[model samples]
Target: MKSYIISENRDSFLGMKLAGIQGIYVRDTADIEKAFKGALKNPEIGIIYLTEKAYLKIEDLVLESKRKNLFPLITVIPDRYGYERQQGVITQYIKESVGL
Candidate 1:
């Protein structure tokens, strides 16, 4: 159950890497798709952390994957700039799960 990160910038990538989470830096939709597909195919990867900016580009794909797979839990996290005012993906999940 290893964790991986998909970051939009080098800063975020390095930060997560320093925390011991292996990651890939993606600047476009194609790169995001590639990284996500690779992660999904790897059985050892059980958790995926995506920066908010990266997640926004592939939100539909991420949601669909989450609904279809039981492993490799996908999570969206804030980058160095911090979270947006709108609700985040994880926050939505938590609210739905606890019926809040």
Candidate 2:
């Protein structure tokens, strides 16, 4: 799968793409499923950094990734507002998965 970005805004998408993530920009929650599904189909996706809000909206997809053995690790990122305690989704997922 290809590394993708599920952000509500464009800045994060541009940044990720510039950072060599091959990021696909998603505009809203509805677009997330289509974009993510496409990413999951690609073999190049080793890590997917998505917005916390977006991930939460589609928590089932992320949870499914955990239940299944996949190559591209699903990660969540905070928006430009900065990381919030309840929305550090990526960290939370990792911590829960590794029991860290």
Candidate 3:
């Protein structure tokens, strides 16, 4: 399994690409579903890094992956625009799942 990088801007993705990331996905518009689907298709993609805002938007896809027990790890990151802590529900669920 390989790794993948997902970002909303091309500049946001360059660092990973330069580091020899085999797969990179960038969403021009605000379509999180499209980005999620694109990354999910690749069997080699073992990890997905998402900008925080984008994570909130397309988190349903992340949930589906969890339901199916897919192992591609999903991590949230801040984009150039900055970070937003708007996902209280998901955070609670994650905490509960981890027995925290």
What ranges in model 3 sit over 4 Å off? 23-25, 28-31, 86-100
Highest TM-score against the true fold, candidate: 1
> In candidate 3, residue 70 scores what lDDT?
44
TM-score of candidate 2 to 2 decimals: 0.77
User: What TM-score does prediction 1 earn?
Assistant: 0.86
Task: Give a tens-digit lDDT track for model 1, residues 1-100.
Answer: 8999999978989999999999799899999989998999999998999888888888788887877777778887889888764656577867533434
The lDDT per prediction is 0.84, 0.71, 0.67
* Candidate 2 lDDT by residue in tens digits, 1-100: 4566767657877788787777666767778877877777777777777787777778787778756744677777778776665666567767746534
Off by over 4 Å in 1: 85-91, 95-100
- How many collisions between residues are there in candidate 2? 3
Q: Which residue pairs in model 3 clash with each other?
A: none
| Strongest candidate by lDDT | 1
lDDT tens readout by residue for model 3, 1-100: 7777677656667767788765445454455667677777877788878766666677766666766754677776677666666568577658534435
Instruction: Give the C-alpha miss distance for residue 45 in model 2, angstroms.
Output: 1.3
